[model samples]
Target: MILDKEVQRKLKIEPIEGSYNSYAVQEREKKDWRGNIYLACVAAILAISFFT
Candidate 1:
């Protein structure tokens, strides 16, 4: 699974050959942790505006 591939990468383990490109370094670069943190902050702001 792609999750395993990503986890392995984060843990510095080598993934098996012939896996899909979902976790390729180039593609994952755009969707890194910083991007996720930004998205989370945006979502929190939207939720706050909606509720209060």
Candidate 2:
């Protein structure tokens, strides 16, 4: 498959290794409490909708 020039350019460019690692670590350390609550609400809604 052929890639676009822009995509090729982006793929060839490398981010700073240390900064990339730290950014990934920071992202992993962050929590999404609202997302968890939203998922729980959706699960509860589905359970009630189907089980009742």
lDDT of 2: 0.62
Clashing pairs in 2: none
lDDT of 2 by residue, 1-52 (tens): 7665543221233355756443222222336599899999999999999998
The candidate scoring highest on lDDT is 1
- Candidate 2 vs. true structure, TM-score: 0.41
Clashes of each: 0, 0
lDDT of 2 at 34: 98
State in Å the error of residue 19, model 2.
Answer: 20
RMSD of each: 12.0, 9.7
Candidate 1, superposed: residue stretches over 4 Å from native: 1-31
TM-score of each: 0.40, 0.41
Candidate 1 minimal-lDDT segment of 10 residues: 21-30
